[model samples]
Target: MSEVNAEIARFDLLVDAAWPAPGRAEDGGWVYRHAGGVTKRANSVLPLGERADLPEAVDRAERFYAGIGQPCVFSVGMGASPGLDDELGRRGYRLVDPTLVMTSPISGDEAAVGAAVEDRPSERWLRTWWSVDGGRHRDTGEGPARTWGERILGGVPAGYVLLEEGAVGRGVPQGRWLGIYCMAVEPHARRRGLGAAVLRTLLAWGWQCGADSAYLVVTEANGGARALYEREGFAVAGRYHYRVRS
Candidate 1:
């Protein structure tokens, strides 16, 4: 709830939501799965000490991944123990991107949320988001679009995608709570207050559905986003990183 950084924030969320991969080590730490998304991280604070690879621990991760046949995403951040990077690397896993974590409470009024993404606007908005993402994500399928879309699709936790839309904007809510996972207004759509409207709609959806709190994450470097969220009344809650295996 405090304004912690991304690492701490992610750790807490993972502990609360992610399901650990089986063959958990009794010593501590675990592989987690949430909503069908699989990732590996330390649950409780564990020791990397001087010696990074503890036979039992290394073996557990390898065996678990072998069983699942999926790449276990390792979110490396502040709470991460030493040698984890090296240990996992030696085993052939790589570190991924270290994305920022951000949050804010709902604020502002008069905006509306449109539930069930409208065929025209929703597509437009998502397409813009895709464009903004550029070569970073291959949603366009020309390569960038295809690659990015696949990355996101792959990264999504199972139960979450299987359960909810995770889209928030003015006037949309299926339940008491709505998650604003990807909130992007088209560059052409910017400054028109669509973002604010989206937030309002998301809150409305939540309230209408009976949700108590609304939350989201952003990176510190995202100046425009941070400003918008701040103006809208969302405060920095914490940060977390989704370290891509290198």
Candidate 2:
């Protein structure tokens, strides 16, 4: 595979490892993921390569997700089947949440006093992660937030760094590389260098864990996050998007 394809494949692995799905299988050049009734990333089809029976594949995807009470969704990346996005578009699937995957060299920094990095997420880290990501809704409603939280935050065998009064992030290692995820700062904590601090801590941890390169994914519309990653030497290595039939 080319560099972009390799990076994107690695990113997809990281996503699967980090988010996790209780029910996962493969068919027709696609990876089907289902996690009860939680987030799209954990319950979507990943079209990785070309296949002869894409229509049957789409039907299978629809049935699989519908069996689990979820609308069908597909993750299309740079390495996905050519024209898959257009095919989905023609099938009434609308595009959503375009994301950029970025990579950079790992450079250690001084660890902050309040920063806590661990192989598993702490209670505070879990709460902070969901609060900033999309966990707050379950606070009042009868949503499956806890289940989603458990799968999203508890499945990774990687570093979970939480900075009290600062920020929170995750770093999952795959071979000599680490992929960072869930890096978030509270609204009150913005513009205080805490975001950079969270990244610095993850880099230090990745380096200590023998990682040479580190990567992270951010939505294409998140300019502040893009700027921050760029300042840390990260560049856009690949991109992906979700197409859903709701």
Candidate 3:
């Protein structure tokens, strides 16, 4: 692999460790993950390395998710096996959530502002996050999905940040890399700089924890968030999307 591809693979590994699923299986180089269908990141397959029998591996992944009563989804990133995405597309899997992985260096100059970082997510923090992001799926209601989401959050050690003004975010520092997740601002709190404050607080916390760089994933459809991350000096480091069979 080239240097760029190797870097993408490193990020992929960091992302997997940062956001873990309770139910996990391995098929060849593909990881079959399921966490009550709460989030695509937790439910989808991460196809890394190579598979000698690609078709059989794909069929097994489909059956694995079918057994769990969820759609078979594959996360296609730069590090995915060659031609796996096209094969899934030919198998009638539609694409979704073309997401950009943005990254920036933590300069240790970010101010914490009004946000507070906690060792674990509080009820208010989870409430704010679910309120903003829970409607992504028809079955992702706050009650049961919240239980599953909490499990995923606790799977790894990380810092959870909540802004007093109704914004929330999470940061997972691995070595010198910080993976940011669960950034959200309440509808009533838009345009008040709370989201940026929460992001800055997380960056500050990550830097204090010895992380020199930070990364986060955002869908291409979210223009407001893309703008915020760009202003924070995060550039597109890689791209990934999910192919889901309905």
Please list the residue runs of candidate 3 whose C-alpha ends up more than 4 Å from where it truly belongs after superposition.
Answer: 138-143
Model 2 Cα lDDT, one tens digit per residue, 107-183: 65535445668888878887777778775233313247666557656676888888888579888877778878888
**Candidate 1 local lDDT, 1-246, one digit each (tens):** 234544353544443332232223333553333222312332121232233445566566545644645444555454555566666677666544334444434443325544443312344444554555433422221234333342443332321111022222322222333345556565655776667666666565455455555565566668888888778767665554443334
Question: lDDT ranking from best to worst?
Answer: 3, 2, 1
Q: Which stretches of candidate 1 lie over 4 Å from their true place?
A: 1-29, 32-73, 77-101, 104-110, 113-125, 138-177, 244-246
Per-model clash counts, in order, read 50, 0, 0
Tens-digit lDDT track for model 3 on 117-235? 89999999999999998876454432477788889999999999988678999999899999999999999999998888889999999999999999999999999999999999999
What TM value does model 1 have? 0.52
Pick the winner on TM-score between candidates 1 and 3. Answer: 3
TM-score of each: 0.52, 0.89, 0.96
**Global lDDT for candidate 2?**
0.78
In terms of lDDT, the best-performing candidate is: 3
